[model samples]
Target: MSHEARQARLRPTLISFDVFGTLISVRDSSYGAFERILAETGAHRVDVEAFWEHWEHRNIVHYCKPYRTYREICELSLEETFVHFGLTGDGRLINHYFDAFPRFFLYDDVVRTLDRLSRRYRLAVVSNIDDDLLALTPLQREFDLVCTAQRAKGYKPDGALFRYLIEHAGCAKEEILHVGQSQFTDLVGGKPLGLTIAWINRRQLALDDSVPRPDFIFADIQSLNDLVEL
Candidate 1:
């Protein structure tokens, strides 16, 4: 049975979002920047598609470390990834990834939806990214509250990040609806914090049974716009 049906019922007063893949498409921008850096060497070649796969896994791995801002991790990732591929070790070329940080792809109806939703519900962002990286997104203007791992000193799934937001937002946990894509980050992290989560399952990937459960599910952020009107 679906959570919406099983629960007593919920009418969220505030909506929190996950920025990266949900509100913005950083995958292409991140990959393209890496591609340019790779191209500068001119002596190295790599499968661009494979680059994203390996890069994403490495990124997820970086989160397991003690704690570092996403930008720092990405900077290190750029250096290590290129070195591992036997590409040029030029930091300047790799630093371009950070230089072109603002080149992110915003999702459809984001501004429009936020514009509508903000009227009724508070809006916030609960992302796994660091302080600087999360601020780079165009959606910053649209958020009422912004919580980053740097401020929390821990990434998502650690629950510390969500707890930071709960305290910062000054809203009851029940009233806060955390809308995100990853159950690992959103559900597992926020669940313990007592923040209701709306799982934005955009990839059509099947949910792993072991993941912490979510309060609600949406196909994507596009579908969440209605929450404001409702």
Candidate 2:
């Protein structure tokens, strides 16, 4: 551990993580799944990159409107993407993606970081995902508490899930550190609740002024352990 990690070892009682982008490489996994499905269907003309972007946009729109399983949002957004592209999608394609979701790989550093962090602090997950889908990920066993949008009936940026974490985990707002890759969902959303936020900028994206800045910014979870001793 570094000097900062040594110095900050005992403050937080709980550490919460945003699941999809922070721990798993959702973008890569989604793109690969889509690419394979399109290739199989001979939908070679579809612009895979553009299609995925539109799907993501639609997914976010649906996520904010009402409570739905993450799989349902994915299927709905995919159909919207198909309509936008003038392609009639088969239901099988949606199922294919859903099945592949659980298989999404974790970031190389996640397992080791979680192993170390779990030893020091109570670990929890605050995710935009549904309980079923989240259970499919390898991280299911690592966390002491797993709070999801499904259980909260709303997504991140809505605050329900965070409230659930606080109540269920029996931790005070200041005693928890929220770590995630999304500036909109995790950092901006959790900060106002009086929870310390750590922005895991795995992509090294430039900061936007409109979002609330995080208390700490790390290139990845491994670096986080360097600053806070897991």
Candidate 3:
């Protein structure tokens, strides 16, 4: 469907967001923090870029397993990273990421756009984080609903988290528009559940043909105000 037609059809009462890369800036900061940790720990031989990818891959692998808190998953991934690099690093080093994550800055447009959208629709957060961590962020705006992987016992890209969202959203699946940056998680998971998916293409990356396409695509959250007019 055309963008105009899709916009006209979408009358979502609840707008759900992906917290990390969508509303907040985490990727670059988290990588920088990881690099700092490597430097501080004296593991100068470990390549930050390679270690970042390996850690992320481990995290994603863990997501498919039964269930574990995000903190445990992070530590496990870090442990695996150490094993991969043949470095006897401290597992507690994962605490650095935990400490740094909650303080990560939000996207410049996030608060302004969320504030504007709040006047019309109920705003919700659906993230792959623990509640305690999420609460530490600047996003303590009394969102109408907050669903975390810790509460749901499942992470995104898996249908379990989105299923939890649909069950508690107090509305039809079609009435919730899930806006997120990750094509793998939000788009792949939410599309199968009947929720309208909006892709926030902040990086302007090309969509892979293997994944399901999003219902709407925007450069950033600020564009959502235009799509969901009052």
Best by lDDT: 3
lDDT of all predictions: 0.72, 0.80, 0.86
Residue 61's lDDT in candidate 3: 82
The best-first sequence of candidates by lDDT reads 3, 2, 1
Per-residue accuracy of model 2 over 1-230 as CA lDDT, tens digit each: 56765886646888889988899998887787898767766688898889887887787777667677877888888888888888777635867666787778899999888888888888888998877777777675757887898888877776777778878878677788888998877866687778888899999999889888898888998877665654
How well is each residue in 106-191 modelled by candidate 1, as lDDT tens digits?
Answer: 87767777777778778888777767666665665846788888888877877778888888887677778888877667777778
Quote each prediction's TM-score. Answer: 0.82, 0.88, 0.91
Those runs of model 2 whose alpha carbons end farther than 4 Å from true positions after fitting are: 1-10, 40-42
Model 3 over residues 147-183: C-alpha lDDT tens digits? 9998898988788899999999999888889999988
Model 1 backbone overlap count: 0
Candidate 1: list runs displaced more than 4 Å.
1-9, 41-45, 79-94, 140-142, 226-229
Model 2 weakest lDDT span, ten residues long: 1-10
- Which candidate gets the maximum TM-score versus the true structure? 3
Model 1: lDDT of residue 35: 76
lDDT at residue 229 of model 2 (Cα atoms) = 52
RMSD of each: 3.7, 2.4, 2.7
